[model samples]
Target: EHKRTNMNEAIVEKLHGTLSILRRERDEVHRAKELAMERLRLAKEETERMERTLQASKQKYDALMAQSTNNSNSNSNNNCSNGSDGHGGKVNESVEIMQLKKEVERIGREAKFQHMEYVSKRDTLAKLKNHLKAEDAQRSKNIRIAQETLKKRRAKLANIQALARNHISTDGTSGGSASRGRANDNGNDSGISGGAGKGKNRTSASASAS
Candidate 1:
């Protein structure tokens, strides 16, 4: 009877261990399933988010394309209004955009070239103007110097003329005084001769009377 009880106790312990092992395995599997479900849910949410983003990107692209088409149509209409063939109906928007890009580049190049030319011309003009101004200033200085010299020469000439006039007057007076002195001397000699002649005639008359 003791052997039977021991055997029953061992059996009961073995069954309990097996049930505990099974319960642990089942709980592990359930946890694993839950983790898998969570992962799937996260993947689904990410996919939906990506899809929404893609849809939004697509919509934005469509809107931009529509706007570009409208702008291109309007530009074509404007070109046609100006009697242009709007690219001759053979060129699409992309081709026209490329052509426009090339044209813009060409225009930019031309503008740059023109700007450089203008700068060069402006510099040349500035130099010319400076040179002209310098020449003018030099001319002005020369004119002023010439005028000053002329004024000085005129003053000298005037002084010389005054001195010449004074000298001429003084010489004329001296000449006149010398001529008057000579005339006085001649008259004195004539008077003396006349007196001598009268005395001789008187002496002869006295001798005849004696």
Candidate 2:
């Protein structure tokens, strides 16, 4: 029974340790999840801003293309009327239009990339959530087992006390028996001494009479 109690206590200790580890892991997982969510939110906001920039660039590019068409027509009429060159203006307008188009494309690519990153991180967060759920389940199970073992330990404590009392009582009984045995031995020695003294006295009287 004592051995069983020791084993129970060991199991309870192990379960307690396991609970502590699980709690630490749970806390770590929660922090990781929170960090991931913060990153995702920032990424989402950035993606939206990039998309808005892309749209503005597209609108500007379209306006430049329309203006280029109008300027070309106006330059043709002015060249016919005043005999002047407008090639430099056209070249600068075309370059501006091209730059705006490129900016639009670049912004679009960046928005798409940020979106993909958000999706991947979101998936990772889901996995972490599932792992946290499993950890909670295991921790709860360990708690229940520990509680049961503690009850057994309490019962074992009572048994141990009872055993100690019985042991003390048995030792007291044995000590009393040993003391009685010693008294009997002392009584026998006294009787033997008395018989020897009487025999010595009888011999002395018989010798005196002779």
Candidate 3:
């Protein structure tokens, strides 16, 4: 009866130990999940901010384009006005107007180029977001695989425990006999005082046979 009680108590202690290990594994998995979610949220926010900046650049480019068109119309009207006037100053004023129109056209082309640059930047931001998403997915998958591996290790540990229990139960009466066997295998030692001694010389012979 006492032996049975002792066995039951030992089993309960082992169960508690296994449960503790499982709880630790679960907490680690939860922490990893939280970190992944935080990264995903930050990446999404950055993508949205980039989109807003792209839209603002597009609006600025369109407004500059409209202003350039109005400038061109105004320059044409000034040329006509200069030709109709009889004053000697009108020819010089027309020449100045032509130069100003050239400058306006240059500014318009610069605005168009700036718009193209914004589009390229927006595309790059999109690619970054896609890459981040793929990385997040891969991280999540790896976490799942790790958790599964932990579960399998825990199961293997349980099996080893069971085998140990069976060995102890069945060999309860052979403790001294097993110790004698081990002592013979290792080469028996007797001592009144201790010092270094040669290890068993033929130890690897049995291992090599196997």
Candidate 4:
């Protein structure tokens, strides 16, 4: 009989130890999830910033292109007027027009390069967005699994407590104090679980806002 009682006590102790370990693991996973969410938020913000920069660069490039065209037209008009005066002026005007053409070509090339850079940034942003979505989905799955595991663990713990109480009562042992202690422990566990739930809700809200 004494051996049986000792074995029952050992079983209860083992259950308690397992529950504590599981709780610690759950906490660690929650922390890791929060870190991943923060990183994803930062990545989204960076992508938005790049998009704004790309838009500004495009506008600047367009303005420079239009100005180049206007300058070329003005130079052409000036050359036509100077052609009525002399051959020397015409030759000088021709050189000036060549220089202007070279400048316009250089500006065009720069605009093309800028556009390519913008396209590259856009592609990078898209990849980052896709990566963030995948991470979010994975994180949600992990959290759901963790919650399910916790629920199962809680159920197991409750069963163990009930069995322990029943065994002690059947043996006519002084188990009231132990039962009360277990109840207090369960209350503490409930509080921890509630806090975890609140944290999860807050995280969800933040993700939605982002």
Candidate 1: pairs in clash: none
Q: Residues 167-192, candidate 3, lDDT per residue (tens digit)?
A: 88878859888988888766644431
Instruction: Flag the better candidate by lDDT, 1 or 2.
Output: 2
RMSD (CA, Å), candidate 3 to true, equals: 21.0
Number of the predicted model whose lDDT against the real structure is largest: 2
Q: What is the TM-score of each candidate against the true structure?
A: 0.50, 0.66, 0.39, 0.42
User: Ten-residue segment with the worst summed lDDT in candidate 4?
Assistant: 84-93
Question: What does candidate 2's lDDT look like per residue over 57-137, in tens digits?
Answer: 888888999999999999999999999979999999989988888888888898888878878877887887788678777
Clashing pairs in 2: none
The 10 consecutive residues of candidate 1 with the worst lDDT sum are 1-10
- Please identify model 3 stretches exceeding 4 Å from their true place: 83-210
Q: Which candidate should be chosen as best, given TM-score against the real structure?
A: 2
Candidates ranked by lDDT, best first? 2, 4, 1, 3
Candidate 1 global CA lDDT score:
0.62
Worst 10 residues of 2 by lDDT: 1-10
lDDT tens readout by residue for model 4, 103-182: 55665565556556555655665676576567666666665665666566666666666777887787665566678889
Q: lDDT per prediction?
A: 0.62, 0.82, 0.60, 0.65
